[model samples]
Target: MAESDAWILTTGLNNGVSKLVGEGISQYRLLRRHPKDVVCIGLTMWGTINEKTRIDLKKASQIGASDEACKRQIRDDVQEDKETLDPHHTHCILFDSGNLNEYLSDSQRSSFVQYVCDDKNSHACKEVFFDNMNFQQRLIEL
Candidate 1:
């Protein structure tokens, strides 16, 4: 793959889909002995429990502020928190979905798709929707 090529894996760090893909990427890299050539990016929604906790603690001093104020502060602070990536991942992308069930907007989806598939050489990419597939089926498909 060219330096511009990348593999975008959309899933949360703690979720089953992410684990499966991370493992697969690791194994494939090991087999080829060229880990640096494969860029595995994990994309996930912000505001997970783990993420909130870390952000809260980091901004503990501001907890006493008004609810709305605290919320705004947390939002601003979390935006700068770049350590959310899973250890096994090569890179990370976080989307600002207010709630867990919120789907990406049409433009967001299009931009993300373009980013992953933009490479001229056509690197392979897979998107696994956890709600649409059972764990066993996802593993087999991947």
Candidate 2:
């Protein structure tokens, strides 16, 4: 996608498969600059992020808060299933469902992705589905 300047979107979370995707994109950027810069975007539920990140984000969202006031830590929360944003990702979109433990369901994520893909201003020309892949499977695909 970098070669064509396409958008590389993933379920936004600095965990598991998504983490690997972020790392791969980071390495790709470091290795070459000829084709174009890759726009790797992550979209995930706000409640899924670590407690610290969530608190910071909420504070920054206050009416009078400055954008500069927010700073995300790149560490996982102590709580299981909580995650932080990947440092390597170019952008992140966090959807808030108002509950701390609630996250976007697979159906919701799919609908959101489809909505973006159908938009005229979408970054990628096509939708790329990603699944959890073992180390060997991912390496072989490359």
Candidate 3:
């Protein structure tokens, strides 16, 4: 595939697979000396527990409040955390969801998949699907 037509989209920055993908992309860029050829995007659920925890800690420290009080304030504040794009990623997209890694609703899943598959720049394609049982097998085969 042409480098400019490539994109690496991940579930989140905090996962093992996502980290590996980031490292792979970084290595690719280094070897090719093409820093902007591909896009690395991290897609994370809004208000996920991990995200909330980080925001809570920051808010608590900033306002000098107890944890319980901070939690209350966070509820009232209701603003989403500022984007902290992973070092390896070039961009990020956040979606609204109740919790972490919850099955995305049909519409949301469709939209996300469409974004990946029909990206304007992509022409030819390659995909690897992995699951708990077959992930190792698939990787070995690849």
Candidate 4:
């Protein structure tokens, strides 16, 4: 299947909004791998609401704030950016993860995690994971 066709497959995932973000980065890189894809997938797992949830997204170069701040920033930025950019041109996908069940299934999240781990998309995940490892390790310490 073509890139566009594969994008359609992600459209049905629980992480659809995030997959779109990652795919946009993939397209931006002209089919080359990008660090954003894995970050986007990881962000999707953090849940969309609750300001604390978005802290993980701060690792993405495209996002400028911690997870909590990112939730509010993304909403405002997307709305403002949308005024000047076409919907399709807006590279970031900003839906609430609190509503993830409305969009993706448990299996879909597993698929996303796998995709991020897959060698083909490991760059994104590695970047995201490194940034979050300190935090994750602290959690383990607890």
Candidate 5:
């Protein structure tokens, strides 16, 4: 329960606050407020990703089928479910595992990759994760 330690969970993050609570920890305060006995996700802001990939390869009459349509249908279903459940959680969305690559340009991506690479063995990723907190604290300086 060190101030710098957290119990992290790996989920799609699309499930939103309910899933966060259902999995354990009633709130996102684990990221702060009450840092002890925290519950956190390694990848956040992934609601869009969860909506994009799913598999429901079952034919109308057949039990098993391998078709693009089936996969798309399943993906859509997953998206619907995730969309319905997302929201209600207020927390900084920590990006990891190339999740934010789409928003970054090639140069920015390279810079971030290098930054993270510099801390590959340490928990330096958390600094970026909580960068907003730093920004907020500096609002007066602006």
Candidate 6:
């Protein structure tokens, strides 16, 4: 349990562990009344997501891009190195390292969790990353 709001972070891929995370979120959402009660964030590397898919994501955020246009972009695509994002996630954060192949470094996720746990610095939001975690900012994540 957490003294403050909780967050769920994942790679956002529709396969493997990330896929399971998405399913869990779906079940949680079913019982919760408010949609914003929980935050499940999908963090992924920009290089992994396809170019057109990237565009669709951008447009999807703004004007609500048509489902058909988004479909056309991936019509000819064969599933290979690229990953399909889990639809259950509430938000997707694509990190661009400017490299063709890049993933979340341990330090990247670590630092972010640290910042969130450190309530003193996170004046913008008072969120407790985990139970055993305090202002000391130990490796507390979920």
In order, what is each prediction's RMSD in angstroms? 9.5, 7.2, 9.1, 15.3, 13.7, 6.6
lDDT of 1 by residue, 1-142 (tens): 3343444454536456676666766777777745456566666555543545445534665655455544443444455433333556777666776664343344664577565456556534444233223531111111
Question: Which window of 10 residues has the lowest lDDT sum in candidate 5?
Answer: 133-142
Q: Runs in model 1 with CA error above 4 Å?
A: 1-6, 34-36, 52-85, 98-107, 115-142
Candidate 3 Cα RMSD (Å) = 9.1
Tens digits of per-residue lDDT, candidate 3, 1-142, equal 2343455556545546776777777787888754556666766655443455545545746776556545542454566543333568776566766554443243663476566556667555534222112332111111
What are the lDDT figures for the candidates, one per model? 0.51, 0.66, 0.53, 0.34, 0.36, 0.64
TM-score, prediction 1: 0.46
TM-scores for the candidates: 0.46, 0.68, 0.49, 0.21, 0.26, 0.61
Task: Itemize residue pairs with steric clashes in candidate 2.
Answer: none
Candidate 5: C-alpha RMSD to true structure equals: 13.7
lDDT at 139, model 6: 41
| Superposition error at 47 for model 1 (Å) | 1.3
Once fitted onto the true fold, the runs of candidate 3 whose alpha carbons sit more than 4 angstroms away are 1-4, 52-85, 98-107, 115-142
- TM-score, ranked from best to worst: 2, 6, 3, 1, 5, 4
Residues 1-142, model 6: lDDT tens digits: 1234556677777878778877877877786676445676777787777656677776767665666534534446555467767898777778788775576675666666666666563444433232122433324433
- Can you write out model 2's per-residue Cα lDDT over 1-142, one digit (the tens) per residue? 6545455667767788788888998887778855367777787787788777776766857965455445543445443557888888888888787766676676765676567656765444543444332221111110
Q: Give model 3's TM-score versus the native structure.
A: 0.49
What is candidate 5's lDDT per residue for 17-132, written digit by digit as tens? Answer: 43554345444344566445444433333323433432321353355555653455342334253322233323324333444223213343235435544664654324222211
Summing lDDT over every window of 10 consecutive residues in candidate 2, give the lowest-scoring window. 133-142
Clashes of each: 0, 0, 0, 5, 0, 0
In model 4, the runs with Cα more than 4 Å from the true position are: 2-53, 66-92, 97-142
